[model samples]
Target: MKLTRIAQLGAVAAVAALTLTACAANEGGSTAPTSSESQAAALSGNLVGQGASSQQVAIQAWTAAFNQTNPDAVVEYDPAGSGTGRESFLAGAVNFAGSDRAFKVDEIAKGGFGACAADSGIVEIPAYVSPIAIIFNVPGVKSLNLDAATVSGIFAGTITKWNDPAIAADNKDATLPDLAINPVHRSDKSGTTANFTDYLSANAKDVWTWGSVEEWPAGVVGEAAEKTSGVVEAVKAGEGSIGYADSSQAAGIASVKVKVGSEFVEHSPEGAAIALDASKIEDGRTDGDLAFAIDRTTTASGAYPVFLVSYLIGCEQYKDENVAALTKAFFQTAVSEEGQSSAAKNAGSAPISDDLRTQSLAAIDLIK
Candidate 1:
């Protein structure tokens, strides 16, 4: 996995008006002559997408850029959690779905993508990337270094105190008080939950016996919050509180340095991109599906394993050409360099590498 220096690929601040002036500038949608030209020729329609609150910021940027070019287009994207988005898609209630986790094999086998033909295929494209940062609000502590076991144990309810020996062992030099440790978790079904739990389940199996499931383990010990905002607020409102969220939301909180390989690594766009680069396409997918199976157990020196490859999923063939054309156009735009830069600017996300973006555009072409 090759990584571009985060310094060189820094994100630009995403603004609707600015994106509009860029001609409303730029999608796979890359093979086209140009984004402006292609988007200008798009048909007028309304598209509604639901899912993946994690991608909400990126979606805002993408839609802003999209609407700038296709003025007739109306897009309403609900920041519902991934599960709800998938349910809405499968139920035929939404035009498309934004998800952190792609459709499972069994789900694809059900042949239930609502907008497509009975036996049509589906397409999954990875459009957004970010590190899952563990944020904290402990008084007097500006930073923390933690291993998988200690973190898992804390959320698992095995470690209750902020100054537990396990935690202190990882940070022997830091001053720690004997205050109670409060771990905040998402109450809604979330892709972020799935990634965080997957990491714990992969590295701290003994302590995280509940395994990796989207919703926090039933009855798990932690303050339950509704979404990213709720989780962030919950952590901020309490002392000795720790919560995990996309690094884009790391406005005023201290973040954790997680154990990765032999060294504790701080989250960065380059690190997150390395982990994403290490991912492999999931097996048993149709020829056109672009879903990835991220390996959260990676021990690469700079790769942050706890990461998400958010996706925009749609039918291989929509029943309506207008829907199909609009979906294809928007997806193409979202996967383009400008679209990715917008997301990075707005979400503190790492832009997809050119190789992955090229592959994604090729896959986008399959969205007939």
Candidate 2:
């Protein structure tokens, strides 16, 4: 798969940062290592990861926390889009990957993760969970109530006006302007798009006929932006504009209250966690793989159906032992209580539950 120029540039930056970190670790030390660094310094190497712009803030927090104990171990992550990140991992361009989605059963069956030894299993942990907010910018509307059908219709280019009857019916309290609605989508292949499209496919199939996809479907016309930030920026710049992004990145923008059952539910970290708890693991996966099959059609009260379960993906066994060790340590730190709290505080993402954390650590332990 061909990476975009931005992704290519990010890859270069990741390598450069790794080189710089290694150089710093090897510098003639007049200064002593800090307590956090010297406590049990078993790890000392660079771990480069790529993928998922949505997890950028969380990744920042995770790397920071991981560096505290393993100061000699550098973790450099690039916020490339998910598809590019997965491709990089499969090509062995990066030590591990952070993706908004896990490798599918079919893809794993093909068995070509270059970082891993032949016949080795992979570890995929749901490390980040966040609601996908339906954000919009309208002249007078601070927020609007929308069902799956209305949301799908608006994005599918069927609902072109801000004052459409479908939208008006959902929000009787607001004065929606008569402006034309501009729907924006990710120009790059994105896990956010996949999750949003999956929700529409599961809940509004009649209107969203394109099915679940990472790329914007061909001929489904809309304004296209490069990443989550791009989509958010597009929506902010245009009047009566609508887009979807991880809730952590949707601050300062008006969002939709999606109808869960009889009541409309606003997106929240707690609500995302509830929806995730209602989801089941994908069947027939290896012990280390924990890919979730989210139930986007769920009508459970207080559950936000639209959410992304981003994963930290690595091999159960790697071609390089040092790579395996760094991946294990970093993954352990990411799923730890302190790590989750850091992410929650920094990114507004939902922390994985204790049961999930236990499972994640168990999977990470398999790395060697």
Candidate 3:
């Protein structure tokens, strides 16, 4: 799969940065070794990773933390969309990828991932979990709870005004405007779209006919932005606009509280953790391939239904021993409690549960 020009530039810059850092380290005569160089030495080479713009904030934090501990190791991840990340991983353009979705059954059957041992299967571990916030820019509406149908109607274009009865029912006390509603969506092929669509499909199947897919379905219409930041910006700029984005990216915007079972639940780190706890790994797959089958339709109280678990997709074995070691080391840190804590500080994402952590660590040990 071909990468967007922006992603290609990012990959080039990452490699160049590593090259310059190595040259500087050699000139300094400091055998103590810088973190980037040490990682490079450990991985025996430079590492390139790309995919999942939804995890951009968390990835940046993880990269910074990993660099501090392994100075010589140079690792770069570009926040391309999940479709691009998966394509890059399958094409052998990256050492690993960060994605919101696992590889499809067909892709696995075709032997798309070269990183796994023959029949060893691929690893798709959910390292980051967060709520998909329904952010809006209505001037006075700060808090709102939307049931499944109302949300489906707004995005489906059937409900065009903020003062529509469906919305008014959810916020009976608030003064909603009669202005036209603008619904913003991601223009790119995104895992955010998949998660959002999955929620809609599961909860309001009659209103939303689209099945869960990375690319938005045809005939389903809305204003489209290229990334989570773009969608957030669009909503912020347009009055009466609503958009779906990773909760961490919904800065300065009003987010909607979704109705869960019997309560109107606001999205929080705790709520997301509850959702993860309610999920289980898919039954099939080898021990090394840590793919999970989350129950998105779960009605577990206190759990936000819009929760998304982002995965760090990587090969079980790498041709370069150093890359393999670096991948394993960085991932080990990521799955650890310390790494999860660091991510929460930097990105406001939900940490993996202790149970999931144990499973992930055991799976990472099989990476060799």
Candidate 4:
């Protein structure tokens, strides 16, 4: 799928207006009571964030929406990969970070101001939800069904042809081509890579051989691109090319449906929501650290098990009160019903369930 190029001028202007309005709202206070008051109270300054190219669509929506209401604040997010985002956040180069995966236990152990809070630890809330679409660009085939093994085999360079029996068996009705299958992968250490590898490891462990890792595993390899955009572009330019990316980013590409169990399911916001709803929160974390143990192998009828839950990581407290306020406001808006819905529309991502939304708001409260 190709990434849409919307003009940034209008988006930037809209965001600027939002920043001003948010600052005024924070200063003047509102007589009207609303469910998002806490979020409003935390609005006031500029914020810098970086991470997750997979969440680019959702993040752009979020920034644009937040700017509409908080016109006085500025929030800039760089769509770097997950690894770079984590590194920047840990180094305190950014006020917050967007990541597709949660921080490792070792990262938590490293004491840092942003990593640690006054009373609680840092907050990692799953805010954006979208399926990792298995996108393809093949001339003759418009649709295909790929099981976990076939997917792993293709990316691992084991299955090299478009007419492999395994692939043909899944798409018997369609005309199969004998073209060489060129699989694309992420060159950087990315959470998207982690999610994809995790699915392979969990479902096709025996054949895959490699376990999930942040950096791509050594044995299984393919042509690698730097970011989600790079992978999308590569797939678009090459015939018989296949790659996995966030569903929203696959705008003009043909995505393959995967057989989750007995059903062949296409990636969708509703389907991603089903998988997220089936997940449970991770245990043994502090109050401020809101991590989840996502069950990616869920076989629920409508759920796409390969969905990605992009997290918003923030410090519990900021040295600058204005920065704290801005962070809180941004987070509150992100977890709000309106905000989540906006994201759904602009990014093709699912909003968090009410149960998770309630918990997420409570976690944002700790950001002060």
Query: Model 4 misses residue 296 by how many Å?
Result: 2.2
State, as a TM-score between 0 and 1, how close model 2 is to the true structure: 0.89
Q: Report lDDT (Cα) of residue 265, candidate 1.
A: 87
Candidate with the greatest TM-score versus the true structure? 1
In candidate 3, where is summed lDDT lowest over 10 consecutive residues? 2-11
lDDT of 4 by residue, 1-368 (tens): 12222224235643554456556767998644224453434354668888898877666666677665665667777787888888888877888888989886677766574533443368888898888989998887777898989988998888999999999998989787899998898989899888888888888887777788768766565678889989999999999899989887888788888887799898899988888888887887777677778786889898888878889998887766777677877787787776677677767889998888888888888876
Against the true structure, what is each candidate's TM-score? 0.91, 0.89, 0.87, 0.89
What's every prediction's RMSD, in angstroms? 6.2, 6.7, 6.5, 5.1
Give lDDT tens digits, candidate 2, residues 233-339. Answer: 99999987899999879998999999999999998998899899889999998779999999887777899989999999999899898888788887887787767
Better of 1 and 2 by lDDT: 2
> Which stretches in model 3 have alpha-carbon errors above 4 Å?
1-44, 114-120
Give the alpha-carbon lDDT of every model: 0.82, 0.85, 0.76, 0.78
Backbone clashes in candidate 3 total 17
Off by over 4 Å in 2: 1-40
lDDT of 4: 0.78
Query: 231 in model 4: Cα distance from truth in Å?
Result: 0.4
Candidate 2, clashing residue pairs? Answer: none
RMSD of 1: 6.2
**Per-residue lDDT of 1-368 in model 3, one digit per residue for the tens?**
43332222323333344445547767987655322234433333456788888777676555655654555566677787888888888877887888888776667768857555455456777898888899998978987889988999898889999999999987889999888998899889899889898888888989988778788777776798998889998998999899999988876678889988878888788888887777787776767666666676777889887878888887776666667777787787677665676567656789988878888877777665
Off by over 4 Å in 4: 1-43, 113-120
